[model samples]
Target: MTIDLINDMIPPLKITDDATKALIWMEELRLHALPVIKDKKFLGFLTEEMIMDHNTVDAKAGDFLLKGENCFVFEYQHTYEAVKKATDFDFECVVILNDDNEYLGVVVLSDALSIFSQSASIQSEGGVIVLSLNQSDYSLSEISRLIESNEAQVMGSSLNIDKNEPTKFRLTLKINKIDLTHVIATLERFGYKVVAKYQEVKSISNEKERLDMLMRYLDA
Candidate 1:
């Protein structure tokens, strides 16, 4: 859960704190923005730019109009939910609150992305298959069965509406095996439209190895 990724190192701004104090904290912490709270409840985010624009050495934190007041997620929510909220609000971090709506901590964008890169689907050796399907024809269970019959498994999958064709959608499946020839043929035999396929390198040994493989892939 996202609660596990909460970053408690960055302290929140107190409503009574002045702009001078906020600016100092921002510089020391190396963050562009910090959350403001009153009585353990989140108010909003205060940015360095907001403070600098005011040009007040002693302006109270409460005097500024903070941003991302509604940009938050409960601690029990999924990590992807935090990512989605950050994307929707265009905030660098997402505030986390408990069931009582009290501030818990914030999840920085970099940490969240790091967790995703280490996920099984992204790190494991695999091949990606992109299929074009009608909205009504989409069914993961059916697709998985077909892939399984070909001695392969769907490690992960994502769906998106085709912008060029509103009536159709694109399904991207990440297979655990590097060779997708059998899987692609099985899907096509089962009336699935195989639009594209790409093979991936085997499981990486370490961060440096993973990065080296990525660089080589990019160069290719």
Candidate 2:
């Protein structure tokens, strides 16, 4: 099932609202910024720093420069898009809009992350493998084939361009098994540079402990 975007909505502030009121809302909601809407059109984001810098409580929200005027996603867009926008803008939240450009609400960064962590791929039993490769050599199909050949399926994958090395990319993969020794060897053998690996040891240990407790109760 798809995630319900409305479930993560944060209220908005009208452009005509007082700057002080916006700041109050930000503080009450424990957020650094809030989306500003005028006539159902998202104008921009009102941030606490802007309010503090303006040093005037009586001014309208429109008086200050809003941060994320273009930082928004359509309501029907996947939640991953919202998360990506938030990251790209370093925003505390991203604005959401309807097809008509009507202001819907805002998606808090923390809420998006919480929802993402509960996704099927994340909840599944898996191990993570990070590989560094040149942008030109990146191929998902080839990587998936290599992983499948080793009897392991790729549960999920994310690609990030290396900041220090613009020509290089970092590929993170979630494999369906905790033991990645063979997978690492296989990838290395194919000339894929393995940068890091994360196994599901703690989760497996916790599950085992719970099962043992259940067995003890049954025996008693």
Query: Using Cα atoms with residue i matched to residue i, what is each candidate's TM-score against the true structure?
Result: 0.71, 0.68
lDDT of each residue in 1-220, candidate 2, tens digit only? 1135553436788767898888778788888888888899998888888888888999998887788788888988877667667767888788888889888787776666665555555657778888889999999999999999999999877777765677999887878999999999999999999987876544423433433322221221
How many clashes in each candidate? Answer: 0, 0
Clashing pairs in 1: none
Candidate 2 local Cα displacement, residue 139, angstroms:
3.6
The CA root-mean-square deviation of candidate 1, after full C-alpha superposition on the true structure, stands at 5.3
Candidate 1, 105-214: lDDT as tens digits: 89986687776568687678888888889999999999999999988888877676765677998887878888888898888988999877778776666645544433
Regions more than 4 Å wrong, model 2: 1-11, 27-30, 37-43, 49-55, 68-78, 84-90, 97-104, 134-137, 165-168, 203-220
Give candidate 1 regions above 4 Å deviation: 129-142, 157-172, 177-220
Backbone clashes in candidate 2 total 0
TM-score of 2: 0.68
